[model samples]
Target: MVTVAVTAVAAALVMTGCSGGPSSPATDNVAGTPSSGASSTSKSTPTPTPAVVDVTPADGATGVKPTAPVVVKVSSGSLSEVSVKDAQGKAVEGKLANGTWTSKARLAPSTAYTVSVTAAGSDGTPATTTSRFTTLKPAVTATYGILYAGQTVGVGMPASIQFDSAVTTPELRAQVEKLVTVTTSPKTEGHWGWLDNRQLMWRPKDYWQPGTKVTVNAPLTGVQTGDGKWIANDDSASFTVGSSMISTVDIKNHVMTVTRGGQVLRTIPISAGRPGPETETRSGTKVIIRKEGTVIMDSSTIGIKKGEPGYYKIKTQSAMRVTWTGEYLHSAPWSVGSQGSSNVSHGCVNMAPENAAWMYANSKAGDVVKFTGSSRVFQPSEGIGVWQYSYANWVKQSALA
Candidate 1:
C-alpha cells in the first residue's frame, strides 16, 4: 500500500528589513505545520491466481508417429481455446471435452506441427502454452494389393494381400490395416486376419455367396508400417465371385466328380495316393489355387530324399495345385495304366493327359477339390484350404473378431 499525507497550515507574511546584505532571507523548514487544502490517500494491488497447462508429445518433440494425438489438459479451469496447425497454417481438426483436448485428424508424415492452448484460472487469470513437433520421415516405401486371377474368385477364396516389406508390430500393422477398406455388394460381412506379418487375408464368416461383388480400397500413401516402411501410393481392386464349382475325389474308387450348383457335371477317372503313409494324399476340402501349363514336381520339397524309393522330380503338364504339401491334379502318362485302375500316385491325383488338361483349363483359383478315403487330413494352411475348418472355427482365426 502507498500512502500520501499532507498538513494544512495558515502562515502570516512578514516583510524583511530593507538591508542591502540580504534581499531575501531563507525561511525555516516547516515543522508540525498544517497546510491548507491537504489530503491523504492509500492504494493496494491485488494478487493473481495460479494457472496450469500441460501438453503431451512434449514441446519441441521430433520424430513422432503420424498417428500420435496432440493432448492438452488444464487445471483449475476448463479449456477455453486450442489451435493445432501444420507448417502451412492448415488447421488440424480436434475436439475439446471436459478439461482435455485431443487431435481428431491423423498428422502428416515428415511435417512440422504447432499447437497452442489457452485457458483461465479461478480468478479469471489467463494462461497460454505452445508446442512444436515433427513427424518421422519414412526411409523406404512400397505398395500392396489383393490377388484374384481373372478377377473371379470362388466362394471359398480368401482375399489375399502381399506387401513389398514386412510389417512386424501389431500397432503398426493395425495402422496399415485401417487404411484398407473392404465392401461387398451383397452386404456380406467379413474380417481380416494376419497370416504372417506381411501376408493378410480376409474371408466372410461363411463361404462367400455366389455372384458376390467385392471392392478393396487401400489409400495408403502416408500410412506407415513398421521398420520405416510407408506406402508409396494408393491401390484399389474389384473382383467378382463365380458359380459354385466344386469337385470331390474318392481315392478308393479312383474317380473325381465335378459339380456346379448342386448338379453333377462330370465323373472322370483319377488315381489318388497309394495306401502306404509314404504316398498317402491328405483328405479334406482344398481349394485349387493355381493352374499352370507346366510345373516342376520335386520330391525334396515335401521331405522325400533323392535316393528314397518314391523320390522323383518331373516337369508335368496341366498341373493344378490343391495343397502346399506337393498335391496336384496333373497328367501322368507313366501312370496311365494305373490311373482309374488303382491308386498308385505319391500323394497326387494322376489322370491321363487329356483328362488333366480338360480339368486344368476349366478350373480357376478358389475351386474346391475335396479328397476322401485317406487317413490323413489336410492342414488348413495348405494352399487356400479355408474350407477344411467349420464356419464357426474359421471365424476364430480372424484378428478383428
Candidate 2:
C-alpha cells in the first residue's frame, strides 16, 4: 500500500510541472500565452506639430493703401505655394524667393484682394491660410500726361512728364520720380529734373544722337501726391530722336544760318528784335516750341498795350514760336529790305516771305536755335529751354541729388 501511494504522488508532481498548472502559469507565458494576473501594453508614435503662416495686410483688413506690401511667410515649415488675386480673379504677378512671396506690381485703389498660402511642416504636415483686404479710396485722384508722344522730336527735346496736379513736396516728388522709368537703346545716360512743380523732364547729358530710341514709363497710379490726393492713372510714351537741326542767329550780322547733320543748309537774311527793354531778342539757347501758320500777332500777349511804344498787332505769316513770353521767327514782308542789313522788328526774327516759309517747313519741335549779340537773357523757365544750363548744373536739379 505504501509503494502504491509514493508512485502515485510522483506521477502527479510530473503532470503539474509539464502541464502548467494554475500556480505555474509562468511556463505558459514563455509559450506566448496570457496569464490571469499579467497585462499587455503597446508604445505608439506621437503626431507632429503643424506649420504656421503669416500674411501682410491681415485677413479682413480694410482701407489699406495700394502701395502697402502683400507678403507671405512661413514658420516651422517651408512655403509651398502662394496666390494673390483681385476681385475679377486676375492674379497679380508675384515672386517667391527664400521662403517669402512678394507682389511685384502695385495694386489698384478701391479694389478687393485675396491671398492664399500653403506650407508644409518639418514632418511634411500641410497647412493652409487665407487673407482678404481692400485698398483705400482716395479723396482726390490726380492724372498725368506725357509730352511728344508718338512723335519724332528734335535731338534737343527732353522726355517730359506733365502732372495735372502739382507734386509739391520734395519727398513726394522723389517718390514719383523713382517710379518713372526711362529706357534707351544703346543705353544713353540721362537724369530726371523737376523743371517746375508740375513738370518733370529727363534729358541726356548731351544732345541725343540721331535715331536714338527712347521709351518712358510712369507707373504712377496710386502714388500719393498729397494728404488726400493720389495719382489715378499711369502714362507712357515712346519717341525717337529725329535729325539734328541746329540754327544759329547772329543779331550783329543780321543773318540766320541753318544746319542739318553738321552741314549748312541755308544762310537766311533776317532782321532780329530792335534794341530796347522788352523788344530785344533774347541771347541764349532756345528751342522751337511749335510752328504757327498765319498767326494774328498781338503785343498785348507780351504785356504791351495798343498805344505802347513797342505795341503793334499784325497778321503774320509762317510764325514759329520760340518763347512763352511772345518771341517768334516770323515773316515780315514790310521789313524785307532791312532783313540782311539791320534789326527792325519787335522781339522776333523778321525773315522774308519765302525764307520764313522755308524755315517753317523744315523745322520741327525742339530744334536748337542759338542767338548771339543780344543783351537780353533767356530764362530757363521758358518753353523747352533746357540747354540754358551746363550738364553738371542740370544734374543738380534732380530730386535724388
- TM-score, each model? 0.67, 0.80
lDDT per residue for candidate 1 within 274-314, as digits (tens), equals 88876888989888877777988888887887998778889
Question: In model 1, how large is the Cα lDDT of residue 32?
Answer: 70
Model 2: residue 116 alpha-carbon error in angstroms: 3.0
Off by over 4 Å in 1: 1-61, 70-134, 137-144, 162-181, 189-199, 218-235, 276-278, 305-308
How many backbone clashes are present in model 1?
6
* lDDT of candidate 1 at residue 128, scale 0 to 100: 69
Q: Candidate 1 at residue 258, lDDT?
A: 91
Relative to the unseen true structure, what is the C-alpha lDDT of residue 79 in candidate 2, on a scale of 0 to 100?
84
Winning model by lDDT: 2
Q: How close is candidate 2 to the true structure, as a TM-score?
A: 0.80
